[model samples]
Target: MGRLDKLPPYLFSAIDQAKAAALAKGVDVVDLGIGDPDRPTPASLVEVMAAAVADPAFHRYPAQRGTPRLRQAIAAWLKRRHHTVVDPNTQVLVLIGSKEGLGHLPTTCVEEGDNVLVPDLGYPVYGQATLLAGGEPRVFSLAAERGFLPDFAELEKLADEKTRMIFLNYPNNPTGAVADEEFWKRMIAFTTKHNIRLVNDAAYLEVVPGGEAALSLLQVASPSKDRVIELHSLSKMFNMTGWRIAFAVGHPELVGDLGRVKESMDSGVFNAVQETATYALGEAFEGLLAEVMDVYPKRRQVINAALAKMGVEVFPSPATFYVWAKVPTEESSIEFCGRALEEIGTVITPGLGFGTGGDGWFRISLTASDESIAEGARRLEGWK
Candidate 1:
């Protein structure tokens, strides 16, 4: 058998293993674990997709850049919802999903041995992608004291001339933390001084708890415009995770680079899905999507309240479908996760999978309903 010399830690795999073991035993698992939306896609998007499939043309090879109709709709939606302007031809590029878009971005830019600034507890792929690109991954700390956002002091300590890109995600995952507009300005200034390109992932932009706005790197001041590339996914917003559809908007120069890599990578997205996404955007989101975004926050409150009642310490996540709750006592993060799964059949993501900063913390998502949330809470009453 062949084997690799080294591979980075498989953080979520351990959690998945423990969760899987319990599931195999027929435990009644209340799955507030994965961040995936448990809701259905909008009816209008579904209707359009069904209609488009009848054309049969969408079954052929799609343009690697996606159809112009989808491209234009993405651009218009960006302009309308984000108040950010982008050119459809050069500045907008489609992806299998934002995950691939982000994973491959470093390969398009970073040379071997170059450094990439990453949050210690940011999305695991940020570092994973950097590794696959043959780049060094330098993690910046995001302690709770720092509100789970990047701390410049730690970032400065890890900086060097080899650094080429900095991966940023606001309304963060695993922490439910967010950065303000001022934070964006400061980040822009810092990156400018360091000559670092910014890769901002705005996947959770439309999924916030109270609709409080998310900060965009494009909106930052003092950097050469387009020094940043912003990414968006239809997964959370339109309930299209399995659809594998998303786009990147920002600096035409950088966006073009991703397009080039993409052409050599795959043929394109499913034409019907792109067509349906375009239809949804053209109608301005109407009431269909509005109803979908409404479901998570109510679920968020349920998990938040349940955690509180169980003496689990947590705060309301500003955005996204996750709740980062603290498990009391002196249990290690991985152990806490194991016990939770074995005892309650409740599988939560262990924060340690996120990185060093997540040590001793556990994350519970509100993917379940109010009754499920209440039941999970009742089960936790046995936890100690």
Candidate 2:
């Protein structure tokens, strides 16, 4: 089959149709499906962007590998936030968004018939990008019993000479799983031994509200020595989802390879956006990050309590703005989520939308507004 034909149907389209039909019937629809933050970008960052936008210096095409100042700021931010250091000149590459970097990554290494190991329960872009690059995506299970982490034994069995890369995400999407320093150490060894590239989509790395920071793969793996790269986004950290600015930091060759692919694929991110991002990652970072993250903990608590009252088991994690819950009934994830919309006029994402490995769970996004969260919680409690 052609690559397009091989792609699975877009999962959200069905959810959108169901939501639209319910709205047409005048039913109140509380959407908790997608993980887009409802919060506004920090005003300080917006002000920076407004000023940067008017600067004539940024009018032309931007630096393909990112401006030196932005790249340096990213390196400094990594050291300040995660205590991980990398060369801004060699290790950092700017992306239009983390998603854009992720989609282009497979092309940097994979050739036709090569395979990439991907989490069975992960952001769909990982596998889909592999397919588009003419590479086969091999699935590795992330079982609930294992705290949604990949089993090293399974990984050993799946990987072979043709395996080009492995993609991991933490704090994970839908599942809200976080990997620690020890996990990172083992992963680095595994990838090094196999001579395969390791990529972590650390989009939610800064979303922790538990007073302890989440670990980055680069913390344990040397970006200069190990074949590893990490993609971090300003989207979740600073509520800049619409701004589409993020950066990749890791092995110099890997960063450069992705940059080379982008040279032909598209222009770099707007210089104005990069400038704004530079400022966001500068002195104002901690304060703005605190403001962005303060809302998720309370929202998480509200949902946790509601789910508890309903006797639904939530995968416990204080990271990311999502609550992964087990399907209380025997119904599959799709049936459960569908019934939720039909009976309660609330939308929750089915785990099966992620992968078959996610078959019996559902995801509740905490990115909704406070009012919507409270209402959705009330409806969920009442439904039970």
Candidate 3:
């Protein structure tokens, strides 16, 4: 309870509690509050995992960083997907999940009282991790005017000698904004000039449409990998959230440092899980990604059409399955979400949960079934 006092309330957990209460009252809830994918893990990946689990070799503790085979698979995947080459032995380190890796990274790079530049309305883990590392977090607002992208001019103002790191997430959580090559180049240049480490959380990179893949920071940061590290997750891409495995790729030094810190905290990801993930990232991944790309866009369409009929305009994202919408009234996001939950029995995420910069908006996840999403929309339409 001591250090816990320093943490902000977990907004999602609170929403879950409210939803449970509604259920207690016998309300049928269309829960779009969480970002978990509704799809099952592809049969191929599960089959590989099932076979791996029976192997006596996989029963042992995994390497603290990752198995050489797993690291090679990740490196190969990066080469094929983003066209970025990396040294598997030196640059790749596995984690329990992207969330764990992102949160623990600051501990290795930031010293007490150093400045950590974080995006407002971005993932909460960035700021929380900064605080846990005893660093001061300076937030840069992501405005809809700029397509929910971070304002470079504003970020410049927040930079100084004390700045140690910059945290970014593309196809961002809650906002559903994707980054392009130009943006990545600019960010790499900015961090390089400041001599600051850049950390990009790329969990949604593969959760994009068929033709357009999200650009990797690694691709732009290249020879400058010493200054940047990117984290990717199997959770969104493979529908493996519960599996809890991800990897960090970057400068050998940064990856090594993170591995050291993780070693002190936990032994490693389960070997069996790592073996399965290695297969997921290898030859079998592309077709599964294509199937995912096909499914989510239609779901996005269903949700978007419903919101439009309710007069709730939103930006159509090229990646990620979230819709960020402005509140119809002047009510606070919490108040708006409260009304939706109590009157309509639909659990939505209030934008304020992301940050104060997101105050006038709310988030709707496209993770529900087509029928469930449509029903949620119908309820909203019926709201007087």
Best by TM-score: 2
Candidate 2: which stretches are off by over 4 Å?
none
Best-to-worst TM-score order: 2, 3, 1
Candidate 2, residues 276-364, lDDT tens digits: the string is 99999899887888888999999999999999999999999988999999999999999999999999999999999899999899999
Model 1 per-residue lDDT tens digits across residues 1-384:
111223477877776777777878888888777778777787778888888899888888887898999899988877676666777888888888899899889988888779899888888888888887888888888889778878788777888899999998876887878778889888877787888888888888777645444665665632237378888888887788989998888777778888889888888788898888788777657455567777777766666766776788885555778888786769888888788887778877777888878987888777677677778767776676
Off by over 4 Å in 3: 1-3, 223-226
* Per-model TM-score versus the true fold: 0.94, 0.98, 0.96
Given candidate 1, what's the lDDT at residue 244?
92
Worst 10 residues of 2 by lDDT: 207-216
What number of clashing residue pairs does each candidate have, in the order they appear?
0, 0, 0
Where does candidate 1 have its weakest 10-residue lDDT segment? 1-10
Better of 2 and 3 by TM-score: 2
* Candidate 1 global CA lDDT score: 0.79
Q: Candidate 1 vs candidate 2: which has greater TM-score?
A: 2
Looking at candidate 1, what is the lDDT of residue 236?
83
User: What lDDT tens digits, residue by residue, belong to model 3 across residues 319-339?
Assistant: 787888888887999999999
Residue 115, model 2: lDDT of 100
